[model samples]
Target: MYLSYEETKDIAYYMCDRTQRLTLPMLVNLLLDVSEKQSDSLERGEAYIRDRGLNWIILHYAFDIGRMPRLNERVYIETFATEYNKLFTYRTFIVRDSNRTELIKVETTFALLDSKKRKMARIPEDIVAPYKAEYSKRIRRNKKPDEVNSEEYNEKQYAVRYFDIDGNNHVNNSHYINWILDSLDSTFLLDHDITRGVITFNKEVSENQLVFSQSSIREEEGLNSDHIIKTEDTVHCSATFTWDKVKRRNMNGYDQ
Candidate 1:
């Protein structure tokens, strides 16, 4: 049976936005941090994986949000690897308030890359055994987001910074969300809250590279945004964000 790891954290001011609610990028970072803590506790952290010439890579993320935690609010985060096939592993993360009301649920897919070959490698038993993740023959496929039509969307350029690279020698996954969200107009971002999101990373972006962030908004049925990140003509990432308009009176309470 697979086991779960959990931790408690308080939303700090640095993790909040102008509305004093937790930012999506920070929330994602925190969730991954809990998973890292668990790996360290099991003595299977970055060092162990590095010694084996393997590096973990995130392929996709899906998020469902009930509400964003407020600054200084305490919350519980729990994570566990549900199952793994030959190439991919599925993981789940849940965040809840002090009263145990769930705030968000994040489903992610990860894979291992052979450092020397720079290609995907099979899931080795030793690495996942510590987490007790169940083995499976089935490969889960998530719905892919629509591609961004550059001519129809707004685009912005960002230079890859030194801090964007992680231990995996690629841009940190969380920064992709930052670039996506930043592509939107500040007024639109401030007036809305992300209720759901789907993101997929297709290629890695290295430091000093210039990438374009593009976005197109839709509101006929409901508020939604499609985004893409690319360098020149090469697409690197794609994502979709569903949002809820914030009512000023209920902003603090996050009542929908």
Candidate 2:
């Protein structure tokens, strides 16, 4: 079922901070919450699918954070079932302000797993049917970076300090944003406001892993510029972060 108006606003608030602009990781977390809530509401007791035994392990996730319009402006975020193949289920999100128009769009694919066995598991039929019913369109899967070619960007590398790893013993998904932002010079970050972003996680970086972060930019005549990140010896992930020349509010300490 589509999320309610009240639910959408609550999610937006959960994702944004004092500045009222949503961050990339916050947007991803909210989408996960929406999907879990929807699954729990299904007729059958299939909500356990939301829990991957311990915590939900992301197979693949990506999102776009649009520029904030104004203070105290109400924004809405909604997630809907997109499609499900044999082992993976796809979900999508759209964010907008009070008028119910879309500001940003996000898509992700997840696989059910037996975490202990580290093996793929079948998604319950009841849970799968609801998503299939909600979204009948074909699922368009995102491409994974080729393992061999992804390593060409290793010239830029950073040591993953102790604090960077989360309770899960892996780099926190949010920290990837911090690393990405850090890769840019202070002048560039200060000069631009992130208007939109698209990121795909190819592999998990473990604790104490000395990973490399690399980025490239291309400026078009009138289109927004593009940026990407890759690990040394492999392109662990790639993203296109677009920025608005006009600054809205100072982000200050809002990296998550």
Candidate 3:
């Protein structure tokens, strides 16, 4: 089901810091929260599948940061299931602010997991039924394949720190975004605000693994530019992020 007007406002409000500009990590966390809530709602009145843990294993995620808006501005947003393949489920997001038409668009893939073994498992019938009912038209059957274009982007280096790994014992998906964002020059970051991003993870970076972060920029037709990231020998991930030279809201109080 789509979020109600008040529900959407509440989510949009929480998406930003006190200054009201949302960060990449904040948007990622918000997506996770909403997915978990939907999962819980589907599993209600049924025996919790202890083997299939509630947390989703993020295979890949992409965000299109559309525009930057001021704090206290009314923004409307919604997220819905888009597809379910043999092993992964896809979801999409759209956001818009008061003065503009569209602010952001995002799509992500997730897998139901056996948390302890770190393996894929089937989603329980009851749990999957509600989502299918609500989003059958949006669900596509195509499965995502693992592939990367290693020759296109230039490679850079990164030293993976201890904090990069999450409870699942591998590099957290959000950390990939951090590495990509860090690869951009500090001056660029300070001068412009990120308006959109599209990222896909090809492989996981484990603890202490020296990672090669690669990127390339292209002048696109729109107001934003295109970007990609890869490892030295392997293309770990690729993404496109757009930026606008606008007054950015201070988000120092927000969690990174």
TM-score of 1: 0.94
- Model with the higher TM-score, candidate 1 or 2: 1
Which has the greatest TM-score?
1
Tens digits of per-residue lDDT, candidate 3, 48-90, equal 5443464456766666666544455665555667556556677
lDDT score, candidate 3: 0.59
TM-score of each: 0.94, 0.67, 0.66
Q: Positional deviation of 105 in candidate 2, in angstroms? A: 1.7
Question: In model 1, which runs have C-alpha deviations exceeding 4 angstroms?
Answer: 249-256
Instruction: For model 2, give the 10-residue run with minimal summed lDDT.
Output: 145-154
**Candidate 1 lDDT trough over 10 residues, lowest sum:** 247-256
Best by lDDT: 1
Steric clash pairs (candidate 1)? none
Better of 1 and 3 by TM-score: 1
Mind giving the per-residue lDDT tens digits that candidate 1 earns over 1-256?
A: 5689999999999998888899998998999899989999999898899899998888999999999999899999999999998999999999999999999999999999898998899988889888888889999988677666557898999999899888678888878889999999988988888998899988888788999999999774578899999998788899998899887735554443
Candidate 3 TM-score to native? 0.66
Model 2 CA lDDT for position 248? 46
* Residue pairs in clash, model 3: 63-197, 65-195, 65-196
Give Cα distance to truth, residue 89, candidate 2, Å. Answer: 1.5
User: In what order do the candidates fall by TM-score, top score first?
Assistant: 1, 2, 3
